[model samples]
Target: MGNKSSSQPPMKWPQMPWTDRLLLSLVTRLRDVTCHHNGTVNRRLFPFLDHCTAANPNPVEGVCTSDITIDSSCNLYVRVFMPSDPSIQGRPIPVIVYFHGGGFSFFSSSSPPYDALCRRISREICAVVVSVDYRLAPEHKYPAAYDDGINVLRFLDSDRLGSIETVTDLQLDFGNCFLAGDSAGGNIVHHVARRWAASTRDWKKVQLAGAILLQPFFGGEERTESDIRLDGAPIISMERADWAWKSFLPEGANRNHEAAHVFDSIKAGIEEAFPPALVVVGGFDPLHDWQLRYYEALKEKGKEVRLVEYPDAIHAFYLFPKHNDNTKLMEEMKGFVQANRSI
Candidate 1:
């Protein structure tokens, strides 16, 4: 959290509509009162917001979950969600290595929004969903989260997770693995898939079936029309997005770095080496243009891609379990995984 100085000008930006101004003002006041500045953000700043970390009863029926350490060296952990559906009762099931989003500086696998979302996805998709709690940035920095992602996949491809009794109960078919996430997590999904596709070391023994990116987080040196048009969009504003990039990237790195701008990696011509992808973008979100551009780029590269757009939705809407659009989003993801299972 940044310092809120009493002598500073009004926090509200110019040209903000009255309603938006009211909301942003309230949120800013809350942050000013509850959050404190440190070298890196400690998201547990607000007592009211601590619910995101507290233990909660599972919100989805017929699904079981457990937390396990993925890499002891880095203290990286993942929450494994498994379904009790009769169809996959005694057989190996598809695996989804899911990453949660908080602009790479907030949120965790145990957060309520992610807990409910992953649980629902496990039941709907009938697959083992490993929700990763990768290291956050302004501390761990760029490649740290990426390395944690690769390590989690490698753990899945091996028999290490099965050492836990609960995980052993649900057979995970690594051969049918898929990677997924929303926002920053979606960006990590892209990087993880690309690295695996381009690697020669064969670090992961299982085949990557596909990737599902829900409103992927992306930025560049130049602004797209949507970025300009939706400068102060709800949930993610241009300033907030810029802060995320600055906080997560290496100190001297610019937005054009391959890590910040995914198109650079795509243009490197790894299309034939990549797996099929499903991209979901919200129509009202600021990142909409970049999401669409990436989708078109994938199609132009001749890679199999499926894009689902919600023109009226807000960014990260699917993270809310009670949101009417969330179920539909989860269904679309399940269908995509099943449709591409043979790949």
Candidate 2:
């Protein structure tokens, strides 16, 4: 693991654009206040700043959302969303299991940005969406979030939702399921799908349709060209990205760990093991090369995949669903789902 010291030199946000400087200042303040010497995050202020929390009300119109506790023991939970589109009232639509991104240490299923995104997805696609609130790192660490993801799939396959009075009236077609996430959440989607594909354990009730990774967070010890090229890019600077990995990855695990580097999967033919995928890359984002490399590797492995690049966009564009780039992304997502959905 990289050094865990919190005494590193102060960030040089003044050199960045005013907007980017403000963004960096706000995030740094939050981290300074919530994070401890041991690297755990408190994050009580996130909901207020992001506009919601697990306890906050759902503000998106045309979508009905409810909370579910998949494992009471660990407080593992998820938020279920269904579109209010009357046309699809009794129709069984595809199910999308979504994971939100915050470098694996922050954010939740209820964070306003993701809430808005999921709301748009369910409303537009007329599908059932499950927003997972996976445990974060430093406190929960790697594999914990991955395990919660896998268990959610297990819960679905157990037919347990049939007993939940809240979701009983909803029509969810399990046979058409997809995994998706942005940044760190995208990393989770990859791992969860890998686990599902490699395991004999059956989630036979649901078919894994595809994976949609938007600006997936990946890293390695060997720095790539883009990492240096966009060293201090807005939202995700090289320093910030390195800190996130160091803070989240398991102790003693370096950037080259399979969990952080998707290329390791290629050796075992695991890229082929993954479901068909749509990988979205932001033109100016620091992680662009890593994301592109993963996409190219998948194609080389002969796995069905597509690449979409927003040449002028930056990281986490999907936070604003109405933005032109994000709108294109959502449309692409809907098309991918419709194409692969079980008939």
List lDDT for all candidates, in order: 0.77, 0.78
Q: CA lDDT of 258 in candidate 1?
A: 83
Residues 1-343 of candidate 1: C-alpha lDDT, one tens digit per residue: 2333557554332243465455445444433444234325655564465355433325347787777887788889888887766667678778899998878877689876688788888888888888999998877899998999988887766767565435538666777889999999999999999888877358555678899999999888788877866665666867777777888898888888788787866766874668899999987787999899889888888899999997666677775445557678878998988887863
Model 1 per-residue lDDT at 339: 86
> What are the clash counts of all predictions, listed in order?
0, 0
lDDT of 2 at 52: 66
True-structure Cα RMSD, model 2: 5.1
Q: How much lDDT does candidate 1 score?
A: 0.77
Tell me the lDDT of model 1 at 215: 95
Q: Which one wins on TM-score?
A: 2
* Model 2 stretches astray by more than 4 angstroms: 1-38, 42-59, 163-165, 271-273
Backbone clashes in candidate 1 total 0
By summed lDDT, the worst window of 10 consecutive residues in model 1 runs over 30-39
